[model samples]
Target: MLALTNATVITGDGRTLLARATVLAADGRITGLRAGSGVPAGARVLDLEGDYLLPGFINSHVHGVTFGPLFASGAPPLAEEAIRRNLVRHLAAGTTTVLSVDGFALPEEVAEAQHLSPLTIKTSAGLTPAALTAAQAVDGAGLTERHLAASLKEQVEAGAVAIGEAGSGHTLGGGGSEYMYIPRRIKEETGVEISPAQARALKEAALGKELDPAARDEAALQAALAGAGLAGRLTPARAQALIAACVLPGLKPARRSIAEAAATARHFGLPLIAHTAPPSLAAVLAAARAGTRTIAAHTNHDSFTAGAMLAAARALKRAGAILDGATFDSFGARRTTESPANLVTLLKAGLVDLITTDYGGGFFDPLPLALKAIVGAGILPLPAAVRLLTAAPAAALPGLAPERGRIAPGYIADLTVLARADLARVRYVFIGGRQVFSSEVTSGITSSSDV
Candidate 1:
């Protein structure tokens, strides 16, 4: 249905990347990707003018829960138009594919997808339901085994794409044992949830080895460590409970959390989109326990040691795990220079991560902003950066969609046309054989013609 020619193609498919080629798209699927300068007859030719064309984005994690104080009297945050506008932003940002956070889809997505229409959406809503925090303490309540089973059944019916970033912020779930720690001061001192710095520090400290190795055995070691207060806030009793319930995924009989997420996905067989980023390690350990190869979004805000991250990745790989850099709102505000630089460093070091847009908020495609940050921060080479946003994420996309990220034959024709020098600034976007947005002009439909 469309031929994108004379363009510098940045195929996110990992194999054919940064190639100067022609991409043929029909019915929203990539029909042909020839590497020469020839065009088929009678195809409406849209010359990219040497701009860049790549697969539209696949965003993994984002909190679309009432995007305001959960207890506030706001007008049902993320209302219909709000969701629509936010989705538009995703389109504008060249995000043809996006996995909305938690279990809620935008109103537009529901309307569009219910008719069996062609809008890229996937989920495991039943197994892992995620909400920022229904109540202040609700953040702790991730999906229980019971919740996972029930929710997964419904998700299969509703067609949810994956499980969740199921943990609570200042949650009260997991026996109040393996909790997201809020410093006694922050809880008593201020109203903000958790400081990013503290989170980073904790991640750093976790890489250390201090488990009762000196006691010659596990129990005497617990006593020796407890004497030293080396266990930190994780009380021995609470830690044991957490090990049984949260940490040691080996003991579970029913497939709860990660295993539940995987089994549901594998049973009905959907890709597990674990809501993550800084939150991924916990989920990864849990999912590995369950023997599922799921994708963790955003992986987190902390600066993890490369060795630790690699070990984690290797472990995940052995268990067939995939990790994505995981983030939301490409058009969202840029982080402080110091913070973003750290993320860039991790990306460059060959850490197993991907660029994912956290869609479902203000409507804006993320490619532009995300590209800007990667480049501005000086992370990868220009082409590599583009690939990070394109090819990398596509590989992590579950279910026969790897081709979806590239401009090769048999690939899905979800593509974006943008400036080569600037991968984010959108010039035109096409998804599923439709010209979703175009910046320049449309024949017989000028603004003046409308009048």
Candidate 2:
């Protein structure tokens, strides 16, 4: 048995916080939690010295940790070492469970990677080619409806948990793509290479009108194109087409591909995860209406202004769909669509249903850091913030809710220990009742007792 004492336990359920408590675990399950120093004799005890104990964070949306190419450059699948390193980073950041969104990696490969890590890893079925292209417009790799359905079935049979990240703009430069692929593609086509900042500026100029590509300012578009060295090389029409293709791909067809994918996911009894942006709201709603339990991923994505995000969030909530807020590389800097202020707006308004890190544009925003920031900003209470990362995500995904994401007895003994002064400073991580990580080993009485 393992006994953890001298801690303030925030039990991820949004209503429990046992100050100076004792948590007991045995056989990979939480046996009990009670007030203070109730260690059973012969149990190994680690005195946390008043640190904050939390249920391990559960990340509902992640990519590039297993089977996906790195955010840009079309690099090869991440190597085993790279995946392990990413897992370690997540563990160090207090993430004990992660749902890796779709990519090229097989379900079996994702399972193998999970087997090697102490973190509880889950995988989603890969995306259809049309959906894939809509997100990024990659050449080739389109899938027929038949093939897409078959693949999703196969993955579900192979233990896949969800059908996710149904669409994204990263590949097409809708959100963070401006930092990478969009500029690369522009340069490839017109020999006009642009910087990441310029790409972001262009994305704002083209997509700022919210689903109305025709509302784009021609002069501004020309200036952005010229600033990227596209002057005289590409017509304004062609430039607008490129921008539209990147930011609003397939929306013109009324998001047929997204609806189809969502229907297929519903057929398989899996929740459909779709990218959430102004232009994609219709698709998200379509999926929800199609009877798929849809998750509007990154509802506060940078593409939408704060007002638009709140409105969309309320609508998604009313639709009985889940609203996922990703802390996309919003650690110390606002690197991607996720800003602390935006996330705060959602949280304060009670619009965010779950929290995750969607690749964080390759930086993989640390959940704890984001949580700490929100809590410190006085935007959200600590216990409520913990639930968004834990119970909320676990509940959002049926596969994880019952077994993990809580500190109550019979729950999986996945726990994170944070320093009292710095909530982001994870000091220890326990997975399945095993001490998988520790910043420092402390002396404790033990021999036959499990640690």
Candidate 3:
């Protein structure tokens, strides 16, 4: 028996609060939740000292955090040490569960990842015919015969909870090209180093946002080349050819796989988490129109202008798609997303159903910090921000959480304790009623018999 007392508890339902509460847990399940102080007799207790207790965050769209084929491109799996380090980062950031959206990992690999960490890891399957073909075309170095041969139904039976990340940056002419492939090619060919933003400018100037070859602008491409310091190193035409070569390989097949994966997910009555960005907007809207249960992953993609994103989000929501806002290191390293304004806009307008941390090249911001940014800006109250990360995601993913997203009786005792003043400062973490992390020693909180 364990008792957590004297806490300001925020139930994960988005609007329930119990000040100075005492919560009881036993056998890894919450046994009671009540306001005011009263630690039951003979129970082990951790007095929270007025900290805010919240349900552990549930992130539905994450990549590169497990020992699986990395991303939708089917690159090699991360090293075992790197995988464990990523899991620890999530755990320390107050996330208790995460769904690996890499979409190509075998069941045994998923299980091995779960076995490597205490965090509850879930997997998604995306090895349909078109999706596999796209993977092969783009970068299928990690894909094995087993991965290619596995069917969606087989993956579901083996414990995959969702179907996603159908069209990724690697396949679409999106961030993967800007941040990775295009830069690699340019460095190899011209010995020029460009940032992701610079790479994006060059790609879009030549191919446009929709990646249409007919939309090319030579003048704009020349300006982009000069801005990226490649004026003498490469001509506009040569650069366009290189960018096209890097982005167009898996483009058509990858676009086809979005609908294919959506149809397969709908056929199985599962949620389809499609990559939502400027390039994939039409297909994503079509998926929603097809009556598939769709989660528009990362609707606040850096590729979208605020108005465009809002319009796209509105259309998808009206078409029955759930909009997912992502924290792609915008609040932290500012690597992928340069600003938090887009996320704030979606949240303020109430267009976002859930919030997640998509791996920003493995530098994704913690979900707690994202919550802090939302709540701190007054766009949402703390309770509402908490819900988007906890209850809402659990509900969206169905089997992903079942009974683990709320700090209520009968739910699993996966809870996070944060400083009342700074929500990002995690003071303690309890997973399955076991204390997995504690900053209490440095936070001036000490165990005592007093209520």
Candidate 4:
């Protein structure tokens, strides 16, 4: 039994707030909650000192936090140590549940990861024919005969909650091409190396943002080559050819897979998460129109201008798609999606339905820090901002722990205690009424004797 007293409780419903409340928990469930509730005689009590207490966060679209098929590219698994470290980072970030949208991990792999961590980890499946072909085209080194032979129905029956992350950047001329394939191919062929941004500029210049072959511009391609340090070494045609080889082979197949994936998701009564960047937006919109419950992943992809992003959001909403924004190293590395401007635009327009941290090549920002940005900008109130990481995601993915995203009585006591001055400072975290982490404790000793 535990009693958390004197906390400003955000109920995770985007509105209800309790001032200086006491939340009592026993046996992993919230036993009682109210203002000035007296602690029972034998219960342990922890004073919050008027700090903010809320439901532990639920990040529905995460990646690279498990020892499984890495990404939609079906790359090799990350080491067990790395997977544990990533899960610990998430635990300390106030996240209690996360859906690994890597899109190719098997249910058994997810179960294995769950056995290794305290966090509740869920997975989505992607075993469509086109998805596999696309993965094979790029990097299927991680996949085995079991993965290749597994059907979506079998995987879902084996406990995969959803179908998604289909047609990813690795196969669709998005982040994967810029960061991994384009640079690798360019360096192997031409000794000069370029950054992901430079690669993106070159690809856009040659094939345009839509990856259309006919959209190539000779002058733009020449300028991009010079900018990327390929000026004298290769002709415009050669540079174009290099980029085409890296992106075009799997582009059409991956795009075609979106519709197939959506149909499969619909048949299974599962939500479909699809890549929603400039290159794949059309296909995603088409999937949404076809009546699949579609989640437009990363609508704020840096490739879009403010206008383009807003327009895309509007179109997706019109097509009955749910729009999600990712804090992809935006505040720290600025590697893939450079700025949080698109997120701001989405929030200001009330276009975003959920928020997540898409793995920014392992530099993803914490969910609380993203909420800090939102609250600091006055884009949303603290409660509303917090909802995107809590109730919203829980509602979006029903297979997620639906009872854990609120502070109401009878709910699972998955709670996060945060400092009022800095929302990102996670002081303590409790999952299912068990105190799993505390900032004041180190090596079995409290940092302050007063604690």
Candidate 5:
């Protein structure tokens, strides 16, 4: 048994905040919460000294251990040591649960990796080979609907709780594929290295519009290519085709593939998590209308302007779809499409149903940084922001709520402790009632006598 006393407890139920509270736990479950130091005799005690205590964060969207290739070419699966380091990073940032949307690795492999870690991991059934090609026509051979259905069913039976990242931009072509993969592919082919700005121009030229491929200006395309040192090496037609192939490999929208994936998700009664941006909004909404409980992942993608993002998010919410906003590498950064302002707009408009960290283009923004930014900016109430990281995600995914989101009796004691002055500074973390991390211990504690 353990007692945490003299803390400001944010219960994560969206309504409770007990100042100078005491939380008691035993055998990995919260026993109770009360005011002051009500430490039961014979129980170990950790005095928080008026720090803030809350439920450990739940990240609804994440990828790294097995899906590193989504952001960089030839990036191998993270080794066990690297995976452990990543998990420690998350724990240090206050996250106790992660849903790894590994697009290529098998569910069994992911589960095996999870077994070696302390973090509670949930996985999704990533796109099948047929679904992958249908979405982007990449390297893999396509699978039939019958085969896809069978495969997903097997994964669900193997403990996959959801189906996603149904159609990734990295695989299907939006920001990730265009900016991350396309530039690398262009360098590989033409031996001309392009800047991120050039890649953005290429994306706009090739896939700016949903159905129209000829929407961009030729002069601008040439200028962008020229800026990237590809002026005389390739013809205009070839450059366009290469750019298009980098994003929309075989199909533009891949409507059939998305529909089949949605159907499979519905058949399994699992939430369908789809990648959505300005170009893919139609496909996501169509899937929602087709009766799949769809989660519009990263609704505030960098591709959409602030106003357009809010409008699209409203539409998704109206269609009974959950809008997920990712805090993608936006900590203490200037305002951009993926900045905190966009996420704030969605939250202010009540369109953001959940918050996540979606790869963050390899930076992987910590949840606490985002929470601190929003709460500090006065755009979101601190309690509400805490709930978004905890109860909201739990409620959004059904499989995680109530049990892990609130600090109450009968709930799993996964909690995070942060200093009152620095919300981003995680001081301690408890998973299943065991102290997995302690900043003080890591900083300089030498022995039991130090305490």
Candidate 6:
């Protein structure tokens, strides 16, 4: 048995607290959580000097791409190793679980390129995107399509648990408005013109190559929607495309999205994860209308009134759907709050359903999740910040809410020991009942940047 004494236990399970308390864990699961005067007998006690013992964070939408900053040029990075490093980094930041997507170098050859470079070089200076220029940095490259699929399958093969942040819902130009409108002249001067007709033709061709006759047909339809404006007017092509893509925002039918996400989930039994921003509400609602129980990673950014939230909730309810919350990190110091605090906005609206980090947000740590709650959500207490991250999402996903994300009896041993300085702090961290990181270890041999 392992016992931690003198720790301020934040049992993320909604208001359960143990001041200067002791926690016991056995067999990698929390066996006991309560307030006691001294350490339990026969337990290996680790003395914590009034630090916070909370559930390890579960970030639902962190990107492997965040490491792109650390990488330069060379071969595609070592994805698994980079992921491990990121996991360790998240651990140090009090995050125990993370959901990663995108920024993996594609083309199966990139994986081989990874094996060619030094661990530091490959892990930091990722393998370059072939068929491109040399000497430029773009964070991390995405995994080859085949490799991403294989990686997902590998998670299954390796008995790693599944959590979906698929990020497949929206494409680059799909957002339409608010995207940096690169007018035709810039492309023309660069000899890179993305004509709607050409884009349509290419999409049609790609669809035909997909072998899924239905999707191919849908792709052709999507091309048409692109050619015509999404909201300007519904031309025949727009109607047909909407029918084909089946993912039009607001008033769109939900068949296409339903079919696609269902196929993905069946293959992996993973949940459909949707990232809903203020503008993407309509499309997200359309998806929910299609009978998908998706995780709404960041539906917290709701616009005032029911125009957005109501449409989505109604559609989701009609489809018998549920979703998860994503507390996205506010841009560094741009916003007053951290990400998790954003929950109070939803919570005040009585929308506190599912909550998780859009982990590996543009900023660092689960602390942002907590800080956002205080600032964005107009909250002041630290305990409340803790629950939004731990309990809310736990109630959403299985094998999670009750078992992990908190300091409690009969819970998973995964926990984060954090030192606080107003909004941010770092002393040491523990994961799965082991001291996985310490500032002391990070001090001598290596710079803490990679941790």
**lDDT string, candidate 6, 108-201, tens digits:** 3324432332111111011212211111211123333443234334434433223233222222112111011122322333344443333333
**Which RMSD values do the candidates have, in order?**
8.9, 3.6, 1.6, 2.5, 3.7, 11.5
C-alpha lDDT (0 to 100) for residue 8 of candidate 2: 95
Candidate 6, residue 98: the lDDT equals: 47
Model 3 stretches with alpha carbons more than 4 Å out: 442-451
For all predicted structures, in order, the TM-scores are 0.65, 0.88, 0.97, 0.95, 0.89, 0.59
In terms of TM-score, the best-performing candidate is 3
Residue 279's lDDT within candidate 2 is 63
User: Which tens-of-lDDT digit does each residue in 280-398 have in candidate 5?
Assistant: 68888888888789889989887778888888888888788988988877664322223566777788888888899887555677788888888888877788889988988998888
Candidate that scores best on lDDT: 3
Ranking by TM-score: 3, 4, 5, 2, 1, 6
Can you list the residue pairs that collide in candidate 4?
none
lDDT of 4 by residue, 352-447 (tens): 988999888777888888888899889999999888889888887787677878998899999998888888789889999888888875412222
Clash counts per candidate, in order, are 36, 2, 0, 0, 2, 29
* C-alpha local distance difference test of each model: 0.49, 0.74, 0.87, 0.86, 0.74, 0.45
| Residue 157 alpha-carbon offset, candidate 2, angstroms | 0.9
Which should have the higher TM-score, number 1 or number 5?
5
Candidate 1 at 3: error in angstroms?
2.9
Quote the lDDT for 163 in model 4. 86
lDDT of 5: 0.74
lDDT of 2: 0.74
Name model 5 segments beyond 4 Å from true.
Answer: 66-76, 127-129, 139-150, 195-197, 209-211, 226-236, 250-254, 332-338, 442-451
lDDT of 1 by residue, 47-69 (tens): 67688787776665544322221
Q: Where is the poorest 10-residue window by lDDT in model 1?
A: 66-75
